[model samples]
Target: MKKLLLLVGGSAGLGEALYSHYKNLDYDIVEFSRSGQQPEHVFLDMSRKETAIDTIDLQFAQLAKQPWQEIVLIINAAQIGPIGELAMSEPKQWWQNIEVNLTLPISIMGRFQTHFQAVEAPKNIAFVSSGAATSVIEGWSLYSATKAGVEHFIRVVAQEQSSKSNPITPVILNPGIMDTQMQATIRSSSEAQFSNVDWFKQAHETGQLASPATVAGNIAAVLSGKLEAGQVYDVSG
Candidate 1:
């Protein structure tokens, strides 16, 4: 029996960490991202929604031909952009953020479900979510909104699969504040652009941020076990 992991946004941060962890466990890893250079990595640019969805469709079609004991998907790619308030954010970047963080993932999920509907494998999916889904962070309107949209969409997907005997179990994983390049970008933002900039800076200075590897390990534990459909799992520092 073989196990496969279809990891989106597997180029950096928690995605990279998960890639390494699962690789060590001997799972076939098909990483999708623009930057990942692994032999199994499929180059995917989330900015181009139509092209990205096409690529994902092709990949899932190929994946459907394989026999597997388990298949897992972890969508960790996101755009933490349009950091400033809505009025001050650039239109092009704001739309790009929506494409990457919302539409693209949703499209990918739909394709995966349709393609693998008949596969009787233990299919699991975990969507990385955020506290921003529930918090109102100033100057983070676009980022916050996209996170909330994705999280709800995840629950909806789970709800749709709940009645299936071999359902594609989907869960929301909230990886709390972490020390990542994304956080670096947040810390570099001026107070005018991000009201909570100082808080991120202080977190970095005080070493309060969780390591990506640690968070990835916690997430792996959840994915490797039996998951309650539509449950929300929070991994904190």
Candidate 2:
């Protein structure tokens, strides 16, 4: 059976790029989006546990009916909000960020862990983390913290799998800064507060930012065992 690489955020940006690259490959490419436009892909709203789990369950149930070799979970779903100090930030926004960024991935992984384990084949799970995971950006506390938490969660999961003698390999990867809608959101919001907004905009316009295709290619390489497990690779540098 051919291995299955499932990308969880196919509606936009990195997830979309990954989906496009893998769609034509010999492996099966399944995507999950919040919107139902991609009828072929799973529709999931990670912010809501009920929606997220239901979508995931449906996908897994379908996969169970198919002859799949492995399962790969690409947790690329994220949302970036206004930049501000934690004390001054809106509590609701902070909670939303945490739910989307940190909690959702954990929940999805927990729900699917057993399903992946039951398979008599190798399994790989990768998290689309960020450079913000390691570096502290002044106004990106919520985003940065959530990313870091994800990386830590990946490491712990990997450790637990190893202890259990499971064949699952988990990795946390940083795709770096890309020319995507999220960057635009930052630039737009930073106009009043950040002097580097123009520089960022120029980078985006001039193709200085990493392309999602390139990131997806690197991820594909990782999936092919070109990259080692438990090591984080920065897609930019």
Most TM-score-accurate candidate: 1
- Tens-digit per-residue lDDT, 209-234, candidate 2: 98888888888776777535666976
**Which of the numbered candidates is closest to the native, going by highest lDDT?**
1
Alpha-carbon RMSD to native, per candidate: 1.0, 2.1
In model 1, the Cα lDDT at residue 67 comes to 97
Residue pairs of candidate 1 with colliding backbone atoms: none
Global lDDT scores for all candidate models: 0.89, 0.77
lDDT string for model 1 (7-122, tens) is 99999888899899999989999999999978889999999998999999999999889999999989999888778887877789999999998898788889989888789998
Candidate 1 regions with alpha-carbon error over 4 angstroms: none
Note the clash tally of each candidate: 0, 0
- After TM-score superposition, the amount by which residue 139's alpha carbon in candidate 2 deviates from its true location, in angstroms, is 1.0
